[model samples]
Target: MASEHLHAISADWLKSLEVASSTGDSTSFVSHFLSDGWLRDLLCFSWNFRSLSGLDKIHRFLSEVVDGKPRFEHSGLRDFKLDDHTANAPSPFKLPGPQGIEGVQGAFTFTSTKPAALGRGFFRLTQDADGKWKALTLFTDMQDLIGHEESSSDQHGLYEGRKITWEEDVEAKFRAIEADPTVLIVGGGQSGLMSAARLGRLGIRALVVEKNARVGDSWRQRTTFPKYMPKGKLANFLDSYAVDQELCVWLSSSIASTPVYNASSARWTVEVQHGDRKVIIHPKHLVLATGSGSPRIPTWNGMEEFQGALYHSDFHRDAEQSRGKRVVIVGAGNASADICEDFVAHGATEVTMVQRSATCVISSTTAEKIIFKVPFPDGTPIEELDFRYNSMPKAFVLQLQVSGGTEHVKMFDKELHDSLRKVGFRLTWESSPGSGEVGLEGFVFNRQASGTMLDVGCSKLIVEGRVKIKQGQDISHFEKDGITFKDGSKLSADVIVLATGNEPIMKTARGLLGDEITDQLSPPEVLGLDSEGEFNQVYRPSGHPGLWFASGSFEFSRPSSKHLALQILARELGLA
Candidate 1:
């Protein structure tokens, strides 16, 4: 129904009630009410006046219409308003009029049966001594009514009420420092440089501190070059038959740019040693770009007693020195494979590999497949090929007995020997084991030929074992008097080359920022070191706020340092 019509009807009813009460004429009031069909129908529906047989029905309807519902007896009128509009007219019945011209005031609530379409509304009514009760005002504001309507249409809980606490607000505030400009970065390696560059581009003033003599030292040290084999035919075979076709495609389509060593900005600082030199480089941020270096040496028996030269892989640069010498290369990884190939190329008289486990080598074809993703033309998969052609040492057996006991030996498994033989290698099993005495003794190997056996002896031996790490200790103590092990063994060696890993050194930044601040700026855990390991907390304890870290964790892939540096720069400078 139109709101205008409802208002007009309501005003008319009030006027009729006022006129009838003042005149005290039942006939006139009844005539006025009967004159309007809409008005009379609405009043009858509110009063629940129904057509029935006896006078009791009339009395019941009059009592209800006059007295109101029992719950609202104290407040006044009840059931005086129609609950809903209907197409048909209400039934006829008698309704009470004002008595002796006294005012009749009350409250009424109107509710809709279909709450989905409409809502309930409550209003207060007031009657003067001369008139009946009429709606004076609605209980709620208009906005509340509109809100109720809108709420019914919303199915998703997006409009639900929410409450916020104070602690959550504080935590959110601290996290905002990620966008702050006061971070410092150390190390020019991929992680450190990238973070600095990215921060710089973001309009943050980032400084990069590096201790290496040059940037990209890790890549440069790898000394990669085009590899070739003898007879030129093998090289040609690798270049044509074994080459991966997809390598060229990927190289051409990749969006990555070649890394340039010395950029125009001079943002990276290099070559400042710790303790011995004093250099001033203060950056708010510090990053450790240092990576792992050489393998560590372990103490062994007879090392000090050895009369011949010994070397670690880190110091073995000249393969020609092994010419005509009997060489034993240890380990089963790429480093061992490379060393074995180097010894053979330099014409070593005999080379044997000693490994701790079965070595799985990738064939050239399989390597090509990984890089190219193309199947072989003949339909043979790359993984089916024999890997012995690229095999490395699998394991080494030491002949030993208890001190002052008979010399009995424990030999390596025959499977290791057989696997080595497939790749043109010879193995020598010891018949007698050496005593477990602390003194150094010579190691022997029996050579195997095609059904013929010979003995090849070597005065020099190379011991390859697990990597060792020592912090806050003297480097010289690692091999004091050419003999040192945790257990008191008198092993002898002429020289020692530690293959222990390298760490990103931020000496320059440390010197500028002081130890306390640098420690706060650079944390080893952020750079992927173990939190509880010996090398944990490796950063110098002081740095600036403008520094940031960019490294990989053991669980995640490492980001490209060059790309990161450029991004950091762009961000700090507001160019990205």
Candidate 2:
């Protein structure tokens, strides 16, 4: 298509949806999407994610006038107002060539039914070969606004109308155990919280145990902040720290033993210790959402002669300690960059980043272009973005998304890329799986490989030499107050911070779960794509029955959490 043609095609097409929806005309609404287009009604359809892949299902699902099971009140455009029309057109991320997709984004609020509540969603209307634009992918979900009651997402349960006091809520949840709960989720991070939320909605009693005192402590523990995520000033992390106090949780505790399974009961005996107290529980399911692992400290040839402070990235939070002192960071990843920036900001005398190899550094905003595809509202249901990125096959995703995304990334990062190169710094682009054995993006997302830093004002610091770069050399040995590298170079440092990554999930699983079960687990080097096509055995049965791993994108965890919950619910009822 010509540039002018592309320019002429805007988000004006959403006007039809607003027009069709305002009048409660189902036929007019179904006409908005192509005949073969799919409707992935996530949180909005029933709050329990559902997908309809053809025009027939789409028509039936949206047609309220016909009555029968086909009558869907919301019609995905429930209460859609033209006044809410928004245009985030000309997406930065391209669909690649061959099956080129030109998408224009629009967002609207709908009245989620089954107990009507305000809902919000993100839509992408792509132009077809016939020059007609239609709904290629529509993600609708509850706005999750204040006071929204349980709709179809929740099955009416014993806790349905019970108004329990705060004291009762805490005592009954923590102190008293329900002889046998259905599921036991370890770790109360996003995965665990969402999983508990799903299981709770499924009418299955579940408990989430976290070692930290608070529900969001897993997130709060990350003293360091991601460049792309909100930066923290006084708070621990300016990110989503979901409140899960209402959900069953035993805080300030950890797994006390290797959960034992019994053939007779078909249940597992698990133990947890909270300070001086120890608690044992029997449950039918176990979920490991404790997250990947701790900071991986690399072995340096240092003879321990250095009389300076040495620590891992996880423990390198307080930069005030390095005030007026020379600091050397031993990695080029995001944490390394953040620490370097922190040291500079905290009044450090000097900061140097030791890069062992080339690093892929992209502008922080590059994420919006590739990941968000546009300036999507932070409140826009995450399911929208999750489906857009993960709905495609792994192979096709590697081919189109990453490959095409890198091109646009290069365009957006031309200046930063040139600046990094002008300096002695070596930079590479993120990899597409089809391009090699394992690329950076695939490795991090698929193989749990080392990450590439998102340059948030750190690149400029490196370019200006305010934060110097030491490329391709390991610390051979430490002098009394400095370090000598394998490259025969020496540098003075008062402190050294190792921003090395962490061990894989298997290693963490072994230490926490038990050596016996860990030995039976898959190999560390292998990334599992179970029968359900999920990574790291998430939402699927691991080699061992009743054991599951729910780890990966914090944004996409809810969907996988739902998948895991449903699988457990099915087994509890002898369905799966």
Candidate 3:
């Protein structure tokens, strides 16, 4: 049973409307109704009804009391059956809206039980001067379940045997953005495109700044292609109220019409070169929606002496390049799975996945298909190859040593053995028998023999490490030919792609807002941003009041920019 309360309908009200009332004792129900002063009166008045028949009489009596025509007919006294067909009947009540409020409206819907059975109509709610909420309006017909037959609609239906009412607030904070003029969007993704379409209906100018040369570049850059194209039904459903082209059209229009400052553009200032040159573009009211970058590679010794092609997953754009090559990939994440499939397809001779820890943290479905499963304490199963769990890498370097009285050098690490064993990895240490005038020759192997293994012979090794941002002068010499470690060892590489992650890149936008506003909008440290980091979803810089920051952490499930743009546009146009 649902609990009815002051200015709020109790679950009991919903339960009472069910086909069959619950047999549960009414003690809890009685207590819940009594919990609210107004609900007690309503329930007490309704208590006189012995059953559905009595309920009809009460409905008539209440209709008379309110000076409204009875919309429902009572049948069979005390056992009165409510005409479910009355869903099409007109509502007789209309409550006044609060003073100073205009165009006040609301809507709700009810579900249907029987197949092909029509559902209930929408109902409207409005607020009174005393700051109280009420159902002041309702749909004329309940037969129209979709609520598209009329200008207003509400639904009331039984869900899990309990009646529920979904009421829409007449006053959403973002209603006016649909009617604004000259709206500028910073990022050209789903959020920006959605915002543009909404604004376009209102005759507003919509513009987007996309640093990339093309739209949807982020999705295209992924190593694995989507299994199927998105149906886009959800986007269409949301845009039913507005008259604009498909979401992509709005995005493409914004991208094509807006002057793009790409690598070839003269306006391009920042430049980075490895295999290809990437130029950075500066835009007015910039949006840092570039998303996450590549994973970092850990430093290791003897890495230079391996004489293999080293690469990160981000830098490996094509698997064809690695076909028939020996490959050792580190890390056990989704990217690793994607790369594994790509390597096999591209004809990689053998693939070895080294997981640092005993168990993986992933879902059961993913675990079942994979050859290995590592369970975390939280009941989340991760692919052993997807995440290393608890392993650390130690650096090795080439050096001179006496092997059979000849000078030789190789990588050596006692720390690697200890760390691997601590994480449940089986370690095997082997040393060549010492000869006269020569020291012991040795090598250590931390391998999972039970899991899938790849033959190692002239294979290309791919290493992926955790990503972190390097600040200030720390990254100044990062692009140099050789990497100089803190321990004073140097490693040379044919190619080094800084797979470091991206920061908020808030320099230009922060300058526009000035210091005071940035401080106010800045996020606390817990949200993964530093103390100086600004993480507000709706931020209007002080100096440039109209400029807003729409993208930052909000709910991880849904991107925040879409929600933020709607709210900001609404407020700017006095729609809220």
TM-score (all chains, Cα) for each model: 0.32, 0.71, 0.37
Q: What TM-score should be assigned to candidate 2?
A: 0.71
RMSD, candidate 1, Å: 34.2
Candidate 2 lDDT tens digits, 1-576: 543444344336556676676666667777777775656554444423455655777677565342243446443345653223233223423454335665664455657444344565556567667978887666565543224232354222344468665556645654443556788888877778778777766667788888877666555555566444542332232113333224677678898878897868878898888668887888888888877676688775653777889888877658897899999888887778888888988899999888877676767687655545542446655655553454433443444435455565567788888888887887755443244432335545564546587777789899999999887466687787777888889878999888887777677777776777767765342243422223545655677778888776665685667666656765776644
Q: Could you tell me the lDDT of residue 248 within candidate 2? A: 71
Residues 335-443 of candidate 3 have per-residue lDDT tens digits of: 4545665666677766544443222122223322221222132333332111111110100000111221112111222343344334433322221224121111111
By TM-score, highest first, what's the ranking? 2, 3, 1
Task: Report the lDDT tens digits of candidate 1 across residue range 33-98.
Answer: 211111101111221112221233322332343234321121122113432342111111111111
How many steric overlaps are in each model, in order? 77, 0, 41
The parts of candidate 3 lying over 4 Å away from their true place are 1-181, 201-204, 225-288, 293-312, 354-360, 364-520, 524-562
Higher-scoring candidate on TM-score, 1 or 2: 2
Error of 1 at 369 (Å): 1.5
Model 2 C-alpha lDDT versus the unseen true structure: 0.64
Q: What's the true lDDT of residue 53 in model 2?
A: 53
Tell me which of candidates 1 and 2 scores higher on lDDT. Answer: 2
The TM-score obtained by model 3 is 0.37
